[model samples]
Structures are given as structure tokens and as C-alpha cells.
Target chain A: MRDLVFRNLRGRPGKTGALVLLVTFLSLTLCGGGLVLSSLRAGLNSLENRLGADVIVMPSKAALKTDLDTLFLQGTIGPYYMNMSTVNKIGRTEGIGRMTTQVFLSSMRASCCSIPIQVIGFDPETDFTVQSWLAQSRQGTLKDGELLVGTKVNVNVGESIKLYNVSCPVAGRLAPTGTGLDTAVYCNLNTIRSLMAAAGALGGYSYINGDPAETISAVYIKAADGVNVDDIVNSINIHVRKVQAVRTRSMVTGVADSLGGVSRTVTVLMVVIWLLIWVILLVAFALLAGERKREFAALRVCGMSRARLSGLVFAEAFCVSAAGAVLGILLSLVLVRSFSSLIEGALGLPFLLPSSGTVAALATVSMLVCLLAGPIASAVSARKLSRVDTGLILREG
Target chain B: MDLKAQNISKRFYRKAGESNYFYAVRETDLELPSGALSVLMGRSGSGKTTLLSMLSGLLSPDTGTVTADGRDLYSMDDRKLSAFRAARISVMPQGRAVLDTLSAWENVFLNARIAGVRDESLVPRALELMERFGIPDLKEALPKELSGGELRRVMLCRSLLLSPEVLMCDEPTGDLDDQNTALVLDSLRDYAHQGHTVLLVTHEADAVSYADRLLQMDAGRISTPDPV
Candidate 1:
């Protein structure tokens, strides 16, 4: 039986080869699109998990942006800031459990640091955002001259980085967050204040320490358990002057809507390609049945039953489709792995490919769908071809 | 044992404005005895092939019954009939019985495989038949690569593989030359002499000379053999 199937496929290479290639293209589209969508979902989840703060309070004069990029964008937008006195006012709000202030400072490209990286300043005693995440890796607090680096920063722990004539030793590295924070550096308030004063003496003015009117970039607030988030957010907007409080839920939804649109488009395209492949297979098998009319008749006269003849046809289809499915899956694996970084750069979304178990499960499902399409298209033709009267065929031939 | 057809007839529907039914084979009674080669001769459209198809169970008669050894052949279900044919009967079709993709050897053993003979014991018998048919060296060649006579000889090997109890040949030498024709005729006669029934259908007059018993067909009816 196997010998017959192989010989038959080899006997008519043109039709068989065309069917195999069509199946391959269909499988590639399914597997590739599935992998990309899985990565996007995982990336989005990671970004949402990393935002531990419930509300972000920034100056009202700044542009209202809720995307993930805004959470860790390298440079401040036009240096909009409110006085540090607002921190006290926000901490006294009704549902606020913890409050902390973050100072934003940017390093120049040709400055003493030599690399333009985002510098974030956090108060060690009051920080509930960055300090909570760092506790998972290390238990100690940040000293005055120590810094924590993001995963993407090309610096090693214990190495000193020169920032605007002030140098600090790297304490530890943070895990990847799949956001702009993956490239930012973190330190206590004293370190950022000292760096700001040192750069000010060298003709560049960003911020000055010990000044009565010092301003901070944003305030991060964590709502207490059993507290209504909407109540706290509304209370802050009413009581805190010249500041706007934004909920993290609103930021995540802004990004989710865009991703949903992309996912829908991919699903529609996959369905269209599948329908095209099915139609082509039906036409090809119908022509093949017509061409092999006498051959089927001969088999019938040789004592081959109708059911056996149809089984042979289905077996042939299975062989070709299995080959094509395997090839398509292998090609998709190479393509997705090779261009993952570029895909992330192009979409401007944090992306992490799904785990190995998920990938294997998806590949198996796609290959099975592709492989079954061939047998389904040929079933009707098989029955029609087998039921033909051998007596008439012999006379006609 | 004997294979007999009793009061058998067949008719086809005519085109519009024509007669309602045209009889291809009129009601006829015939008996083909076991252990001898019986030759049925006729011209084209004389219903020789149609009658042969009825005898081989390829087609059912519109009227009456066909029986082998007192059991009705057409009374059995399709599954049992197919298995009976594969095990006890062999049919050699005209106009390229060999498949285009397989070599002569594969074509010969394919019958043995269909017969459910799983081992290589039939290999020697297949090769021996090919040698006797005078195409021993063409066993490895495809059907397309063989000449007309060589292909006919290969078909002969395929039919003889199962050593069937009843053998039916439909214009077996239709495309062969005189020499290959003599070879096929001699093999069929020898096979029948071995206590198996052989029925040969053809239009050529030369084939009548090799018949152990001759029956003539004209306009869907059979008559006694003409005097030599």
C-alpha cells in the first residue's frame, strides 16, 4: 500500500507538488500569526504586572499620555513639574495608603556620563513602587552612592558610572519588565540631587538641591486594601491643586484597544488564506479523478472493492499533506525566532514569546488543521471515482 | 463443475424520439464447461464482450441467473462476490491492463498481493510465467517502456499469478503480433488443460483455430461453430 502511494505521487509530480506547496503556505500563515499574537499578549501582561502603583500624579501642564512608553520614557516632556509641597497634600488624602515622589532627570549625550540614559530619583524611606520590586532580588536598602540598573543597561554590578561629574557604584540589576524601564537607572533622592547640582556648576541647569522651591516630576500612590480606587483618585483631583491623578487601569486599556484591532486583522487574513487553499485542493483533486478514470476502472476489474479504492485515495492525500505540514512548521519556527527583536521594534510594543509548551501546542494544532484539509477536499472525488462502472470504462477505453 | 447462464438478457435506454429500449444481449442460454478452453467469436457490436461481462459477474443480466457448480453467482452480496472473484477468478482486460507507473514485476505480484498471498513464494512463479511468455528480460521495465507484444505478455503473467480456478480473457491478443498471439493462445490452452475453465473472447478468425470448443455470436445470439 505504501509503495503504491509513493509511486502514484511520483508518477504525477506536477499536481501532487502543487497541492503540497499550497498546504505548506497555509500552515506557515497559521503558525506565524499565532506566534506573533501570543507574544503580544504575554508582553502586555508583563507591562501591566510591573505597574505596581495605583495612581500616578503628575503636573497638569504636561501632556496627558497613558501609554506604557510614558511610564518610562527617557526624557521628560518640556520639564513640567509641581512643587514638592504637593506630596504632603496627596499623602493626606482619604484612601491613600502610601505615597512617594519621583524626580526625573535626563543625561546629555556628550555629558560626563557619556551615555544618554534616563535617571530616576526615588526617596528610599517613602518609595512603595521601585523599592517593592527590588525586594524580590535583594533585601538591603540603596546606599547614598549605590545604583540599580535595568536589564538592558550595558553595565555590571559593582562598576562605577560617572553621571555629570558624580560617580556611583552599581548595586544590583533588575529583571526585564518589557517596557521603557528596561533601559532606565534608579537611585535614591540624594544621589540625583547631587548629580543635578554638579551639572548646574558646569553651565547646564536641570535641578538644584537645598533650594526652597525644588520640584519633583511625579507622585506614585498605592491605595489601601478595601479602599475604592475611584474615590481616592477623585479625592486627589479635588484636593490636590495644579496636579492631575491618573489610574493605571486607564493606561492599560488605551494600549489594549490598539492590540485588539491588530489581532482581529490577523485572524481575518488567516481565514481568507485557508478558504483559498481549500478551493484549490478541490479543483485539483477533481481533475485528478477525471484523468485517472481508466486506472480506477482497471483496479475495480482486478477485484479491488470500492471501499479499498477510496481508502487508497485518502492515504495518498494524507502522505502529501503530512509532508507539507511538517515543512511549514519548521519554516515558521525559523522565521519567528530570527526576526523577534525587529518585530518588537516595529510594533513599538513590549513583546515576549509564549513559553515552549504553548508554542508546541499551537504548532501541533495548526499542523493538524492543515493536514486534514487535504483529505476532506478529496473525499467526494474518491467516492465518485470508485463508484464508476468498470464495464463501461473498459468498452470506452 | 460447469459455469452456466440461463435465459439472460440486457437492454439500454435509447435517446429521445427513438425506441424506448434497445436489447444489447437477447435472452440466451449458454454453458461453458470446466477443464477446457471455450472461444466466443464475433464482430464489433455483436455483444460478445457484453456476454463475457455477464459471465464474469462484471455486469448483472436484466433477466435470469448465472450459476457456478449449482450455486447462483449473482445471488451473493458484493463483498462476498469480490472476495470470491479475487480468490478463484482472474480477468485479463484489453487495451493496457498493466498500470503505467509500475514495472512488469510489480504488476505481476500485484495480483498475488490482492489475493492475500503475503509471502515471496509467488515471486518464483511470477518470474517463471514471465520467462514462458518470452519477456523474461522485460520484468524490470515499465508498461510504457515495453512494446505492444511485451505489454500483452506482462498482462498474461498478471492473470496467471493467482492460479485461479476460472480464467477470462477479453481480446487478450488484440494488440499483439502473430508470434505473441500464438504464445498467449498456447498458454491459455495449457492452463485450461490443467483442469481449470478458460473463456476467451475475440473477433479475429485466427483465434478460432486455437479454440478447444468454438461458439459463434451474431446480433446478441449464439449459434453452433461453423464447419471447418
Candidate 2:
């Protein structure tokens, strides 16, 4: 039986190749869609955990769209500055538990620093989000003239990077967030202020304008336990002037909503393609079986049982589908791994990949979907072929 | 073992009227004895093939029964009948019986394998049959590579591998040249001489000289068997 099926497959290379190609297309879609969706979900989950803040207060003058990227990607779109007074006011709010401020300083294109990286300045003394993550590396604080590099940054920890004629030591490195943060560099508030003042002295890019040394880009605040996050957000928006308080959930939701549409479209496309493949296979196998009716009947006369003959047909489908699924999975993995950075940059969304175990689980599900497509499509035709009356077929011949 | 068909009949209906019936074979009684070659001859559409089909268990009669060694062929379910036929009878179907995908050797051995012939000499036996059919060198060749005469010989090789008690051939020499036709008839005669029943259906009267018994079919009716 095995020999027969293989011989038939080898004999009709064109038909087998077409089926393999179709199955491969299905597998690629399944794997690609599954990987993208899972990656997006992981990114959003990591974003929620990394924020660790209920309400974020940004300088009201900042463009809403750019501010959204600033909150999620740690990206600075132009210089948006609010007086240090806004952080103080938010800190004193009724439901505020802990509040910390971040200062954004852009690197000059020709500056001594390593290519125009987003320099995020955090208050290590009072920070909760990045500081907590840094605890995993057993790092306590970012001292003066020290930089913390994100995973995607070219600089390695213990290496020195020149920032505006001031050499800063790469003190620590953070794991990948699959967002703009991967390329961003981090430092304490004092370091960024020093860099700004040095740039000012050199008559270059400067964030400090005139007098007050205390300038902040955004205030990250955690609401007190059991307090309504939305209420805290609304209270800060109403009470704290010169700053707009946005709930982290709302920002994440905005990106999630867009991603949801994309994922849904992919899902619908997958289903549509699956049905199309099935219908095509059904028709194709039916025609194939019709053409081979005399051959099958002759086999029957030669003592090939109907059930075994049907099994032979199914076996052929399984072999082709399995091969196609494996090929498509490998190709999809290559495509996803290659374009992941571009995907993140284009979407400007926080993209975190799940662990390896989760990826394997997702791939398995996709492979199963692809593998089942062929046999299911050809089942009806195979059954009909098996039960064909040999006597009539022979007499007709 | 003897092949017996008793009071068998078959009818076809016109497409326009369900009540209208055309008898392809009617009230046919055939007893093909062991160790003899029985040839059924008639013009095209005169029910020779239909009667042969009934005898071969390929077609079920509208009435009466076919039995071998007192076991009713039609009474058994499809599976049992198929197995019985596969193990005990060799059927040489009309037209090409070789699959284009398989080599000549594989085609010849296929029936023996399906009939579960597990003898150690199976390969040699198949090769011997090929040699006997005068196409031993064509073993590795696919059906598409063979001529019509060679294809017919390959089919005979396949049927002969079963070593069945009953053998049925339908127009085995239809496309063969005179030499190939003589080769095929000689093989069938030898098979019948080996204590097996051989039934051959053809419109070619030239084959009558090779038969031990001749049966005539016309207009869905068969005459009594006459010794040739």
C-alpha cells in the first residue's frame, strides 16, 4: 500500500506539487498570523506591567499623538517641557500614592554621543517603574555620567559613550521591550541636566532655556490602593493645570484597538483561505478520482479492498500536507524574525515576544490547522472512489 | 472447483420510461467445469460480456444464483465475496489493467500480494510468468512504456500469479497481433489444463480452435455448451 501511494505520487509530480504549494500557503498564514498576534499580546501585557503607573501626566502643550509614543516607546517628539511645579501638584493629589518624574533630552546628530538616541532621564531616588526592572540586574542607582543601555542599543555595559563632549559610562543594560525603548538610552535626572548644561555652554542642542534648573518632561503617578484609577486620572486632569493626565489603560487600549482590527482581519483572511483551499481540494480530488475510476476498479478486481484504497488516498494527502506545513512554518519563522524590528518601528507599538515555550505551542496549533486541511477536503471524493462499482467500470471500459 | 450460474437474468431500462426494460442477459444457466477452457462468443452488444460478468461475480443477476463449490457467490456480503474472488479466482478485465505508475514487475506481483500470497518464491514465480508471456525483459518498464500487445501480456502475467481455481479473461487478445494472440491463448490453454476452470469471452471466432468447450451468446440468450 505504501509503495503504491508513493508510486502514484511520483508518477503525477504536477498534482502533488500543486497540493503541497497550497498547503504551504495555508501553513504560512496560520503560523504568521499566530506569531504576530501572540507577539502583539505579549507586547501589550509587558507594556501594562512596565507602566506600573495608573495615571501619566504629560505637558499639556505636547502633541497628543507624539505624547502617546513618548509614554509607550520612551520616545521624545520635540521638547515638551512643563515646570517642576506640575509634578509637585500631582504628588500632592488626593489619591496619589507615589509619583516620579522623567526628563527627556535628545542627542545631537553630530554630538559625541552614539547616534541620536532617545535619552530618558529618570529620578532614581523616587522612580518605581524602571528602577524596579533594574533591580533584576542588581543595580541600585544610575550615578552621574553613567548610562543604562536598552537591549537593542549598540553600546554594551561597561563601555563608554560620549554624550555632547561628556563621556558617559554604560553602567547597565535592560532586557528587550520590543519597542522604541530597545533603542533608547537611560540616565538619571542629574546626568541629563549636566548634558543639557554642557550642550548649552557649547552653543549646541539645549533643553534648558533660562533660569529654573528643574524641568520635567512627564510625571508618572500610581494611584493609592482601592482608589478608582479613572477618578484619580480625572482629578489630576481637573486639578493639575498645565499638564494632561492620561490613564495608561486608555493609551494601551488605543494601540490594542488598532491591533485588534489587524488581528481580526488576519483571522478572517485565514478562515476564508482555509475554506477556499478546502473547496478547491474537494473539486480537484473529485475530478482526479473520476479520471482514475477505471484504475481503482481494476485494483479492486485485483483484490485491493475498498477501505484500504481509501486509506491510500488519505495517506497521500497527509504526506503532502505535512510536508507543506513544515516548510511554511520554517519560512514564516524566518520572515517574522527578519522583519520584527521593522514591524515595531512601523506600528510604533510596544511589541514584546512571548517565551520560547509559548512560541512552540502557537506553532503547533498552526501546523495542526494546516495538516488537517487536505485530508478533510479529499475525504468525500476518496470515499466515493472506494465504493465505485468495479463491474460497471470494467464493462464500460 | 466448478463455476455455476443458475437461471440468471439482467435487464436495462430506457431513460424516458421506467417501465420499459431491455434484457441484456436473461434466464442464463452456465456450468464451467474445472480443467477446461470455456469460450463464450457473440457479436458486440449481444450479451456475451454480460453473461461472462454474471459468471465472474462482477455483476449480480436480477434472478437466480451463482455458486462455486456449493457456496452461493451472491449470498455472501460484498467483503466476503470480494475476498473469495480475489483469493480463488483470477479476472482479466477488458482494456488496460496495468497502472501507469507501476513498473511491469510491480503490476504483475500486485495481485499476488493483494491475495496475500506470502510464498518465498513469489518474485521468481512472477518473473517466470513474465518469461512465459515472452516479456521477461520488460519487468522494470512502466505501463506507458509498453506496447498494446505487451500490456495485454502483462495483464495475463498478473492474473496467472494468483494461481486461482477459476480464471476469466475478457477479450484478452483484442489488441494483440497474431503471434501475441497465439502466445496468450497457449498460456490460457495451459492454465486450464492445470486443473483450473478458464472462461474466455470474445467476439473473435479465430480463438475457437484453442477452446475445449464453446458456448454461443445472442440477444441475451446462451446456447448449451458444445465440445470443440
Model 2 CA deviation exceeding 4 Å by range: A64-66, A70-76, A111-113, A132-146, A151-162, A165-173, A210-213, A341-349, B12-21
Strongest candidate by lDDT: 2
Q: Name the top TM-score candidate.
A: 2
Residue B224 lDDT, candidate 1, scale 0-100? 68
Model 1 per-residue lDDT tens digits across residues A218-323: 8888899989999988998898898888887787676677678777887898789878877888888888888888777767777777777898899988887888
TM-score of each: 0.83, 0.91
What value does the lDDT take at residue A251 in candidate 1? 78
Residues B1-228 of candidate 1 have per-residue lDDT tens digits of 478899998776667576797777889888888788899888788888778877877677899898877778789876677677777778887667666788889888776766567767788888899889888898789888988778878888888988888898999888888887888898898899999989999876788878888988888888664332
Deviation in Å, model 2, residue A191 alpha carbon? 3.8
In the predicted model 1, the residue pairs found to clash are: none
